[model samples]
Every structure is written in structure tokens, then in C-alpha cells.
Target chain A: MARKRPEPVQIVKQRRDAALNGLVHGVPYVQFLGIEFDRRGDELTAVMPFDEKLIGNPMLPALHGGAIAGFLETTAVIGLAWSNLWEEIESGRFDTDELALGHLPRLPKTIDFSVDYLRSGLPRDSYARARVNRSGRRYASVHVEAWQDQRGKLFAQATGHFLMPASKDD
Target chain B: MNPEKLKMAEQFISAVPHCKTLNMKLTNIGDGTAEMSLPYDLRIVGDPETGVVHGGAVSSLMDTCCGAAAMSHPSSPAGTATIDLRIDYMRAATPGQTIVTRAECYHITRSVAFVRAVAMDDDVDRPVATATGAFTVEGK
Candidate 1:
């Protein structure tokens, strides 16, 4: 008789809630950017509510660019963490609870990021989504799209590159 | 157009509460270029260990310069959102020196504007960081 194949593990479904909590509480800059996580699963979504403190131009009455960048970067990192990439990479040796609670992992530092300004992001109510492009080990890319209140408006888009550490080192 | 730009400048300065806290003031604006200065303040000190401006503050200043450049465009009335900004830090800004940012708009199309800027102390040749950015135009 042929050996029975093991059941496929549902990685994302198992880890979703813990990951979202880590993101909300671990990152200090996330709160500073005033970005709130609304949903997390395969793709993570965040909302950037308008605040005068985050404005770059009071003249334009718009959200500041740095604040937007911070929002996108944070969203990308949280999405990856939620996907259980860190846990999978560190599998078996450590407790899942320890990994989730002890220290939230840092995103591999960004090597480069390119953003295309598509439309004005205004009126304080805006949303963005980040998706990770994973090919193999040691390299990952994140693409983000931000939308203005008018459903049709594509306010901004960004592609960021991060260099992952070697698996054995992790 | 010139008057509108100046009016925008005044409004931009007055609206930013943190800029006021940091003593950042808009000094000049014209011809798709703008200048702003942040006076030395104890609050700006980045590291209690080093007494240099924090990387976060430097990044904010660079972002502001690029955004202001985008806002000064002739067709920009509604405003612009930063799509992306990249900054290369060269050195720590010297203590007790006002950091000045000079930013210029390179091009603008229907949706996006490209900008380049340099932040320096009194000496223009030695810059603290150079930055490039893209901003999206908001609808009027």
C-alpha cells in the first residue's frame, strides 16, 4: 500500500487573528500615520484617515507624502507577517505564541521603492491594499494601491523591494 | 497665478502645527521652485546620544520640500499627494544651523509631477540629503 499523503496545512487561516493583533500593537509608526487595519487574510487592507498633523501641504489640504509612504510600508510588512511567512521560516523550533507575542519581526529593510502618483488623495478618507510578490527564497516584492474617496480615483501606487535573510540564518 | 502660489504658501505654513513647533517657516516660492527653513530647536535633536536631528525629521523635511514643489505647479489648484519619495542621507545636519531646502519641479503631466530637491545648511555645496519624488494631483 502506498503511504498516505499528509493533509495540506492551511497556514493563513490559522494565523490571521494573531497577526492582526501584532500589527495593531507592535508598530509605533502605524499609529502615528493614523492607519487602521480593517481586514487581514491573503491580502491586508488599511485605512488612512485624514489628520492635519500628517499633512504635507496645508495649502493643498492634502495628506502628507511621508505619512503615505509610512502607511504603505507598514501595511506591506503587516501583510507579510499575517501570511505566516515568518512562522513558516522559523518552523518547529519555537512556539507560535512566542513568535507572535515576544517580538514582532522587522521587515527585511527596503532596498528600493518606486511610487507612481495617480490621483490626488484627499478628504481624509482613503484606503490602500498591499500584495506581496513571492517567487523563491531570499527575495520579495510588495505592490500597493491607494484610493481616494471617489471610488474611481486611484490616488497612488507603489512597488517596494525587500531583501530577505537566508532561511538557515533565521 | 503668482498671488495664488503665495497665498497657498501662507496657508500651508499656518496649517501645519508641527512645523510651527519646529520653527519651520516658508521663506520663498517662485518659478516651480520653493524654499523653506527649519530653525535649530532642542526638540529636533535626534539622539540624546549624538544630539543630531533624527532621521524621521530629516525624512519629513525632504518629503515636505518635494510636496511643496509639486504644489507650486501652475495647474495645481486642488493639491498633490506624494506617490513616492526616496532620500539619501549624506551626513548629520549640524546643530545650531538652520537647514534650508530648495526644491524644483522637473515635469508635470495630467496626473503626476516629478520633483528633485536638496537640503543643506548655510553652505549650498555640502548637502545633508538629496531627494526625488512623485506626487498625484487632487481633483478640484
Candidate 2:
């Protein structure tokens, strides 16, 4: 079924504030975690500010294992969204908008998410980067890594599959 | 099995701020197995259009239950931390249904504990997700 293609500018904003997480602005869980993003070219990184609320083991002051997984998963979503937008712009389906990343016609759904806790996440600023390995009509795959200050030293890593709801263009 | 073991397990889970924030509660515990639950909350929705809880929330539930199970394991007496966790999603959980997870410490060596878990809503026939992981154990 053919659908209405939104204006180029509207495409970037999608339906919400695209500058932040593509679909995470109104999400209470993501908001509570205080996740932010940086998009440059094909690379997308998710940054999580260190907060007392994120601590899992107060004694060790370690970040909760689940929170780390959440961080990685959320980053992967943003990365996939950004990757799709980049492709759309390249193919002229969507215009290049430096101000905003285009919106996803439909939110991506998680098919599977796995996390490898390499080292204990300490109570400190942590960041994650996700690389989209493949994005097709039916599915997308991403490999994500979270690290403390040093990029080489990772706290955790994850691989996830997202169900990309097919669009009219597909 | 002992009261002291139960207390230890509960205390360890309660100390986690993320667990408190998510409101995951321990429902039951045996020698090397545990059950946990998180009631449906809109705050954790991944797809606002569908109101389905995010897979991350399910992952959190499994990770916590696994940790609790590791704590109760007779071998991991000192305490435990996650080493690795892998979850495969079967489907998105139904909206407004509490997600429950059950985890078991299937095996334990001197330094590590192996765990597996399943998450589901009310339907016992259809599981929402399944997980397997290993945890590091310390000496008491």
C-alpha cells in the first residue's frame, strides 16, 4: 500500500524530537536512566551520566547489570534508527537534515538481546556505541559495547536483533 | 533452605537500586532457584503505540532472578555477580500484564555458577523470553 511521504524536514523530526533518542524522549525508563546520544556520520554513541539512582550494589557501588543491558539495548535502537535515516538520505528518500535525525515510521521491536558482563560497571560515567551490522525489511542486527572512561576497556557488550516494521517504501 | 540463606538472598536483592526502581520482588526461593516479578507499568513501555513493555525490562527481570538464584545456590555462599547473560525473546509481553521470571542455578563450580531463566506473562503455555548466564562466585 502506498503511503504519504512526509516533508523532508518533518522526516528528520519524524514525529518527535529526533535530536535525542529516536523514540526514547517520552519513555519513562529511558528518561529515568538519563540516556543521551551523539550521531556523527555512520557512528552513533549512547552516553549515560553517572547517577546515584543507577547503582545496583550500594556496597560495591556497581551499576546494576540490568541497567547496563538497558543502556546497551537503548543505544542499539538509536543506532539502528540513525543508520536507517542515513540510508534514506543517501537514496534521496529522505533529505539530509543536520538539525534532526528522521523519525522511524514505526518503532523497532526487540527480537533478542544478549549481554556479556565483562567487568563490573562502576558508579561513573559510561558510554556505549552500537554498529548496525544489517538492516533489512524484516529485521536489523546491532553489536553494542559499553565502556567506562577508556574505550578499550569495556564493561559490557551485547548483540541484539530488532524487528523493523516494514514501511511503504519497503 | 535455611532462614539465614533466605535472608541473605533478600538482602542482596534489596540493595540494588535498579531493582527497587523497577519494583522487582522476590516471590519464592529454593536451594538453588528463585522467582521474581515486575507488574505491568506504562513507564517501561517500549512501543508507545502498543504499550508493550521493552525487552530491556524483561532482560532486567531475568538478570535479577538469576542473581537471586545464584545467591541461594549452596555453592555460591559468599555472593555473586553477573558474568554474562543471553536472552532470546519469544514475543512481546501483553500490555498490562505483570511479567514473571523464574531462574535456576543449574550448576556451580568452585568459581562460577551457571543459571537459566524464563519470563512470561499470565499464559504459562507461551513464554515471553528465556535466558542463560554465568555468575562469578567468591569464597566466604
Candidate whose lDDT is highest:
2
Report the lDDT tens digits of candidate 2 across residue range A1-170: 88977557654544233434445564566776788876554566788999876787898879988889989988888778766666565455553243334333466777888899998898899999998899888899999989998999998999999888677656
TM-score of chain B of each: 0.89, 0.93
Given candidate 1, what's the lDDT at residue B59?
A: 54
User: Candidate 2: global Cα-lDDT?
Assistant: 0.81
Q: A1-170, model 1: which lDDT tens digit per residue? A: 99966534566445554556655555544555567887633556788787767665565566655556666666665665555454553343334475465365544445555556565456577788878877346667778888877656778777776666456566
C-alpha RMSD for every candidate: 6.4, 5.2
Among all windows of 10 consecutive residues in model 2 chain B, the one with the lowest summed lDDT is B1-10
Root-mean-square deviation of Cα positions for candidate 1 versus the true structure, in angstroms: 6.4
Tens-digit per-residue lDDT, B23-100, candidate 1: 677777776687888777655553333456544455566677777778787777656667777765667778778898
